[model samples]
Target: MRLLIVDDQPLVRQGLRAVFAGLDDIIVAGEAAHGAEALELVRRTAPHVVLMDVNMPVMGGLEATRRICAAGRADPDRTLPKIVMLTMYDQDEHVFEALRAGASGFLIKDASPQQLADAVREVVDDGAMLSPSITRRLIREFVRRPALPAPDGELSALTGRERDVFRLLVQGYGNAGIAEKLTLGESTVKSHVQSLYRKLGVQDRVQVVIYAYENGLI
Candidate 1:
């Protein structure tokens, strides 16, 4: 997969490039020090995924992502490259705004190199990726909100088992942990996760957690 790296720090870019160096399936197509440069690079490289930093001079990643999505929408035949916000901030507002601006996921800088690679691969494969802390924040926010009318499309879509899986998921349980908790085999839990993903139109666990929060399911 062709990849673009967008960060204000040269060291961050270098570290990310070095991380991708070990992955044969990924290629670093371009690098940018700021959002404006990122926009230009996206236009030129047409990368499959962008690892974007949220804070930067001239333009922020959020606005850049918005613009990129807007441009892609203007050209219907072209699919926009997946945008992942890699940042130090895990605040509720930041995550929410980034998602609103079309970020496929958000991760912190402290994530291991393998985690970074996994996040890239997830987005490239049309999936979502959010750090564990972000997932927790989303769940807490969702649970704290006043109950609203649940959408029939979202509510009726989930089966009883799927709802159980989703509840544990929002609480930050992995498939194995969930399986153990539910007294089911790992493969059975995996099947339920896949079904939940399809029913919710979500690509990854993070989005599933976010959906639970947004819909007040957890």
Candidate 2:
């Protein structure tokens, strides 16, 4: 997996680069001190995933994420890069906004090297890296809010099995977990997941969670 590290601190960037150095499968594509440099590197290197710091000088990670995602949308031929925000707190206010800005997931700034590596792989594999604590916090926050009106017949478009898969996915179950829970094969669960993605017009698991929360389906 190719990765670009975006942070304002030199030590943080160096530390992350060292972590990935031990992994044979992952390559550190480049490093940037801020969001503007990140954008320039992104265009030049075309990394598969970007490890973005939430707060930075010149341009913030949120704005950079918005721009990167927007660029992908503007050019269908360009593959969208998955962004995982590095944050100071799981309950940080910017976490949700990062998701809204098109970030794939988040990791606490003090996450261990193993956790960092795992998060990178997860996001690249089309999974969201929301830990249990983060998931619970998201649920709690959404519970206090009023639900947005879902588009006409959006939920109805899903079949019974697809709905089951959707619920499990929003609950943070991966394909293998969903298969075990529903007593189906792993490949079958993946098929249902892709089907759900297609019907819901979502690109990844993070978007699925956002959709469920926004429509009051969770």
Candidate 3:
């Protein structure tokens, strides 16, 4: 996997590069000092994943993310690199904004090298990286907001089995875990998940989680 490291701090960029250097499967595509540089490198290197710091001069990670995501959406041929935001602050506002800006994952800046490597791999495998702490904070942040009524018959298209799968998924169950709980095969659970994604117009499990929260289904 090709990885891009983006940060204003040279030390941070160097450190991240070094971490990926040890992993034979991961290649350090490039490094950028700020968001603008990151954008240029992204177009040049076409990395599969980007490790981006939130705050920077010229352009911030959030804005760059928005632009990159938009460009990817507009051009069907260009592969959109998954962006994993690196931030010091674990504030709810920051987390929410990153999601809104199209970040595939969020990671604390202080994360260990292994955790960082794992996060990149997970996002590449159609997964998202939200640490347990971040997940809890996100839940609490949404819980404090005024509840939104789910659209009428929003779930009517889903079958009873699909609903069961969605419920477990929103509660943080993976396909294997959901299968175990539902007494079904892993492949069957995967089918239900894909069906849920199709009916809900969501791209991945992370989007499904956000959808459930936005519609107050959680």
Per-residue CA lDDT of candidate 2, range 105-215, in tens?
888888889999999999998888876677778878889989888765878999999999998998889888999999999989889987887688776899898888888
lDDT of 1 by residue, 1-218 (tens): 99999999999999999999979999999999989999999999999999999999999898998899778767756768888898886978889888867688899999999998998888775467889899788657766788666577876888998888888887868777899999999899889987876677654565665566566564
Best by TM-score: 2
Best by lDDT: 2
Give the RMSD in angstroms, all C-alphas superposed, for model 3.
2.6
Q: Worst lDDT window (10 residues) for model 1? A: 201-210
Q: What are the runs in model 3 whose C-alpha is more than 4 Å off?
A: 76-78, 152-164, 179-201
**Better lDDT candidate (2, 3):** 2
lDDT of each: 0.83, 0.88, 0.87
* Candidates ranked by TM-score: 2, 3, 1
TM-score of the candidate numbered 1?
A: 0.72
Candidate 1 runs further than 4 Å off? 150-218
- Lowest summed-lDDT stretch of 10 residues in model 2? 130-139
